[model samples]
Target: MTWRPAGVMGVAPSLVVALADHLQKLGAVERVRDPADRRRQILTLTEHGRELLGVCAELARSADAEFAADLTEAESAVLTALLDRLTGR
Candidate 1:
């Protein structure tokens, strides 16, 4: 994430670190030393984070459906494609 944040997530590495630290403090994520390389740490989402993401996914789907209600099916497909491209997915 620190290396690919700009392209993959559209955020700065420093910003990701800050946000990850906060989430860790909030029990949404945990950081542990890498078994193979003690100098590095791996970040993994906790149960809380998974639950939060599930809720977020639901809300995002609802909002996207509402936002696309007026567009034709082709237009909706194009919009989704464009968004996926922009997000480097």
Candidate 2:
């Protein structure tokens, strides 16, 4: 997730930290200390975050379907492949 925002989305690491702090405040995620490494923290999604993720997934699927409505099945497949490649998925 950090790699996605920093590398794929081209967001600054500082901004990502700020956003992470904000999410923590909002109870979307919780930070847990790593057992093996006291210096590191692990961020895990909360119940709220899981629900939000499900909603986002549905919305993205809807958007993708709408965006490809006019294209043929083959064209949509090509577009999806291109998008997956571009997103480094």
Candidate 3:
């Protein structure tokens, strides 16, 4: 898989160390040194991060349902199929 920067939301390469330290203090994530490359580290989400993801998923589902409520079932299905085709999924 290709790796892409998280963009502005990411602590860029220059600020990764400081960002890791901040996340550690907040107990939101952890940085682990890769066994194959001691100089490189990967960030993994902590329990708090998983909980936040669940909350966000619920919110996203609610918003999607609301947005599609006005459409007929067939229309909604067609729209979803079109989106899937566009996304190649």
Candidate 4:
């Protein structure tokens, strides 16, 4: 659905489903049917998924640091502030 973050990321529903299945195979997530709607499946992160999230966070932080390395401290702060405003953060 367009309401999903995956949609914002430009991922097709079929790709999302495939990825969810792969995550299930890796014990990183599980899919459960919605009790109210049998056709709808919800993907919930497992403990492994939480660990993966931690790693993803670290990588994102490192990338951010690297990307901002050329900017002065004040410039970095201003850029961050502007980006936050644009992103409605």
Candidate 5:
């Protein structure tokens, strides 16, 4: 998806801005002015960013699987629900 600032939800705007700045600094993303609207900017991920994202996703999946290894299906569901609630998701 094209990254528009408006598409972000449930995150504080300041935190979003800070993350964008950090990513740009790391060469992971670039803020490009929209051609049709020069006043507007769009955040686009660089190749490096895509690679990093893939790695992070894999790590998360591995960690989640390990974390749930000892839990039964019902226990896993309950744990997921409790975590979601704790995170206000």
Candidate 6:
């Protein structure tokens, strides 16, 4: 999703700005003025950022599988459903 400064929620605006700055410095993202509106800027992920996110997703999946290794399939399925409910997904 394209994120504008005002779109950030549940965090301090200053923290969001700082994180945005850090991401930009890491070449993870860029902010560009909206073509139709000079007063607004849109944040876009860079190719490197997309790659990093893919790696992160893979690692998360690995960790999740490992965490459930000791559980029976039914238990894991129940846990997954519980987590999905808690996460509002």
- Number of colliding residue pairs in each model: 0, 0, 0, 0, 0, 0
Point out the worst 10-residue segment of candidate 5 by lDDT.
1-10
Per-residue alpha-carbon lDDT of model 3 for 28-85, expressed as tens digits?
A: 7887887877977778999997887788899999999999999999999999999999
lDDT per residue as tens, model 4, 1-89: 32574666677878877888898998899889989789888889999999998999999999999999999999999999999998872
Pairs with steric clashes in candidate 3: none
TM-score of each candidate structure, all chains considered together = 0.75, 0.74, 0.65, 0.75, 0.69, 0.76
The residue-by-residue lDDT of candidate 1 on 1-89, one tens digit each, is 24455456677778888988998998889999989879677889999999988999999999989999999999999998999997775
The C-alpha stretches of model 5 lying farther than 4 A from their native spots are 1-7, 77-89
Question: lDDT (0-100) at residue 20 of candidate 2?
Answer: 82
TM-score of 3: 0.65
Q: lDDT (CA) for every model shown?
A: 0.86, 0.83, 0.79, 0.87, 0.87, 0.85
- After superposition on all CA atoms, how large is the RMSD of candidate 1? 2.9
Give the per-residue lDDT digits (tens) of candidate 2, residues 1-89.
22255555588867877988998997889989889778666789999989888889999999988988999989988998998998885
- Which scores higher on lDDT, 5 or 6? 5
Candidate 3: deviation at residue 15, Å?
11
**Model 6 quality (TM-score):** 0.76
Error of 2 at 32 (Å): 3.0
Top-down TM-score ranking? 6, 4, 1, 2, 5, 3
lDDT of 5 by residue, 41-67 (tens): 788999999998999999999999999
Candidate 6 C-alpha lDDT tens digits along 3-88:
65544465777788798889899899999989988976678999988998899999999999999999999999999899999777
